[model samples]
Target: MTTLEKKGSDGGGSSSQEAAARRGPAGPGRFMGGQGTEKSKDFKGSGKRMLGLLKRERPLLIGVLSLGTFSVAASVAGPKLLGDATNLIVEGSLGKAFAGYSSKAEAVAAQHGKGKGKVADLLSSVDFVPGHGMDYSAIGTVLLWVLVVYLVALVFGVFQGRLAALAINRAVFRLRQDVEAKLSRLPLSYFDKQPRGEVLSRVTNDIDNIGQSMQQTLGQVVNSLLTIVGVLAMMFWISPLLALIALASVPVSVVVAAKMGKRAQPQFIAQWKTTGKLNAHIEEMYTGHALVKVFGRQKEAAEIFRQENEALYASSFKAQFISGIIQPAMMLVGNINYVLVAVVGGLRVASGALSIGDVQAFIQYSRQFSQPLSQVASMANLVQSGVASAERVFELLDAPEQTADPVTPERPDELHGRVAFEDVSFRYDPEKPLIDGLSLKVEPGHTVAIVGPTGAGKTTMVNLLMRFYEVSGGRITLDGVDISAMTREELRSGIGMVLQDTWLFGGTIADNIAYGADGATREQVIEAARAAHVDRFVRTLPDGYDTVLDDEGTGVSAGEKQLITIARAFLAQPSILVLDEATSSVDTRTEVLIQRAMARLRSGRTSFVIAHRLSTIRDADVILVMENGSIVEQGNHDELIAAQGAYHRLYQAQFAQAVAEVD
Candidate 1:
């Protein structure tokens, strides 16, 4: 049984003295470790960790890799083709000029000699002129080359587009799955300090940003790196001096990018933190909109949101604006180098130290080098954001929790439902023990009630018993064997709980009730609903149990929702039952109905009821009145009343409140 179960049992109420004994010097009991202390540090290993995450689905990763390579090849080849075609035009034009000169010389010699007659005949025809005025044949040849260039470019464009789409989509899917799994595996304490909005930002906004980064940057980074290397090789091959001039800006540009990246990475981290806070505030305001309106604090809420928004804006502006400076700075340096290379290369070509095509090719390579530098600067921003999100995500996955069950879980043939908490002592924080060195033995087929004040560690007790948190000191046993020795699934499968905060998925009522159970029969479901008094309400719905519900049961009444929860719990029909403030949130009439449903649920199973209403558990087999974190009194209702102790005082106070309400 969990700490929640131990404290919720209304029958096993403890006395004030026992509760005092359990309380720490500061206050009531609380987890084995104190609340708000579980820090997640999962993102520590960058290279190995990322690789491990990918190893599970090697085929999918390999496909992404292959497509990514294809995309890079296409992008680089497409640009190279454009430059190559320009050179072909230069070469083809030069060929036509020489051919025309030779043809003219032949025609002059023929006109002056015996072939003069044939030359005159050719000149008269004019249509037979192969190379004349401005080389029409060369123009025709260049037009054909243009058509081929366009056709090749179109093919590469299509290939690049398809490959990019396929590679990015696969990477995003895999990344999302890994993130989801990490979130699921994290301990519940991860949620204690953070706002729902912040958590949502990590899962939704942060992950989406990472996905977008991966999609755009992955190919660009790889292709740009390759392009830079290729261009440098070509430049050196053309003329070492011109190549040296063209790359004069390389070291300076690299130094600038490195310095900018160093400043930008920290700012990106700050920006994301600000984003999380802003998201948390927005989420809180939306969820509590009703309360804000009732209190007429809309302006106040808006002001709070404005503060968070301003912080987010400031952080983002600084980070992005600074990173944005990198591209233009790189362009300026490239432009200066471009002028230097052009002047040097032009002089060399004029002096016959270099060919015209060589100088032109060197100029092209210089421009090409600038492209990769520009790309690196741009993609650097995305990489920073991805790294930040990766860190936060890893933190979540690294949080500590109870040890996982062994490779092979110990599954019992049957559960006898005998529960015992011996010498149990626990604290949410080590400084404040919620349950002092306490012990209890619950025999099979008995109802146990735990009564306590608000901070008396009722829920904590259930948490411990359920092994949601490991015990700080003490042992819990089920049917004479230690529960710690059993697998979590095996231990929890035999227990059913209906908590006050009921949750329903976006599915038909029948589906939610059946949940993880395999193929629940219609009769069995309806029977369980009837037992829990939810069948009558289900019948009233237009779709009965088939009615689909939105998350949180937006369409259903609160009472009906509670009834459905009860029905679902009853359907499980575990060996032990736990009711955690089940009726506290309902109206008086619904409470009575639910109390009756609880009675039916308690018929055969060993039940733990955590109740606030004294009248409801008057017939409990055992009542343990708890205060702070200890049981101060334990006895039947009549016996505790006769003892004139804490339980008696609580009963009297409730009776007086009932009388006052009636008047």
Candidate 2:
């Protein structure tokens, strides 16, 4: 038996054996394996393109930058002003304490009279006079000015945050819209090759990451850069020697940050990739939970989940741990510089080369200088992750899109449903050709049934006819007009399809039925439902036609969902119809009803029916039996059965199986 058949049959196997089969011996790696953590080779180019997304909001960006600059400037100046106030207080207090001595010294010097002796020198040295006790008013005035500067800085900081938020939100909004539009332009094969969860991650998770990074990092980047420059200048103005000592630690901090960033980047990339894989696995498991339970593979599924979760945890922890070290490492360097400046500035003050207040301001500037450097280092990781996300989003935008028609061509005013494949050939891969130079023609209002074993390319033929995929070597025409000549929208407007896998969005039953016919009236939807034999079942529901369905149409049975899709196609009322195993999911009674409904739906349309149940298509005008992507037998039921070819053997086998089941 095949792996799937064995899984279905095994009910009481050893846990290990069942798990090995369900999850494969490779564990979760088989499901989680793919391109892992794609790092951008051209980071600068990606960063430029990422920034280009914000170009439309240049005015907002400029406003944010302006406000941020004002805030940093005020912040830088506040410390100096406070230092000045400190100086005033110190000088006033000292002068007040020496006031009496000054008066005594002047009197002694006058009494000595002779200008040459030790007493004269001592009196000169003791020259002191009493003055006003302290300048409390001047100190208060300076303090008041300092308060105003800080308050202004706070207000400007708020404005900068608001403006940056607006700009980032608007830019991200535009980016999301572009990605949505790009999805529609991409070829169907692109989706076939990619996981739905991975694609969704790009649209939701990746885009949000970019937005958050911008909002958090943009304002800080502006403030940090300005603070660094302003503080460095202030430090040099106070004491060039101390400034050089402070600047000495920057290169060491930079080297440490660079090394950590390099280590953390790949971890972050892996974190996001594994995050996508985990989501994909969860989606798959939840979607097939019923099957998993039916086969008693719940243990296996949980084990698989545990494995994937572990992988995600490992990557996430490494990424956070590596990036987390940058801040502390930078602060370590900053503290070393802080101590050096304090020691050196104190000595200089004792030597009278620098005043106490000037040394205090220099220390404040040194601390300020280290803060922005640390902030910038931390911002580096956030920016790196954002750039990685941007690269993914850009990769989606840069994927190969379906070719556009060279010129706009007008579609026929009315379609007659005549389709001809003139030597059509196609292959998913150029190296392995599937269909080779096949030709066929069908007149209007004829029904063609296609039957074959699995992998016979039955669905592929339908895809080609619908132009979901283009022919590689030949032309397919609709009513004597080449399909490629018209736009995809115009070409597909005349055809309707109903597949075995029914799809329904989250909405009321009436809305889903009316989806195919834009601006269709309520009465028209009911009429189409009746024609597809869905009106009876819908009327049985509590809300009737207004009943809401979930995304997966969970409340309804599979057969019911299939009927609703048929109703949708019926409402479309196209000139050509394609049905691929439309009744495969229904019971015998429902299948009969659906076959009758389908017959009515195909009354005046050219129809192609792909059915595994050969009994349903015995009355078709022609039955084409395909094998290995080419027609091997073609005739009506009686003719093909008498010929005793592939069709006869297929019919005979099915007949024997049915008889055996009855027995």
* Model 2 Cα lDDT, one tens digit per residue, 1-663: 000000110111122243345434534455455334445566789889988999999999999989988999999998899888777765565457545545655544554665544443433332234453567888899899999999999999999999999999999999999999999889766765566777888899999999998888989989999999989888888899999999999899999999998888877777777777677678878888999899888887787778778877887788788888999999999999999999999877765577667888999999999999999998877887888788888999999998886486867667998889899898766676777787888889999998988767787787787766788988898889888888887887888888877788899999888888888999999999998888999999999999999978978998898888888988998888888888888889878877898898899899999888998998888898988778899988999999999999999999999999999
**What TM-score does candidate 1 get on C-alpha atoms?**
0.82
Report clash pairs, candidate 2.
Answer: 102-128, 102-129, 103-128
lDDT of each: 0.69, 0.81
486-514, model 1: which lDDT tens digit per residue? 88878887888877667677899887777
| Predictions: Cα RMSD each | 8.4, 6.4
Name the runs in model 2 displaced over 4 angstroms: 1-40, 101-130
Model 2, global lDDT: 0.81
RMSD after Cα superposition, model 2: 6.4
Q: What overall lDDT, based on C-alpha atoms, would model 1 receive against the true structure? A: 0.69
TM-score of each: 0.82, 0.90
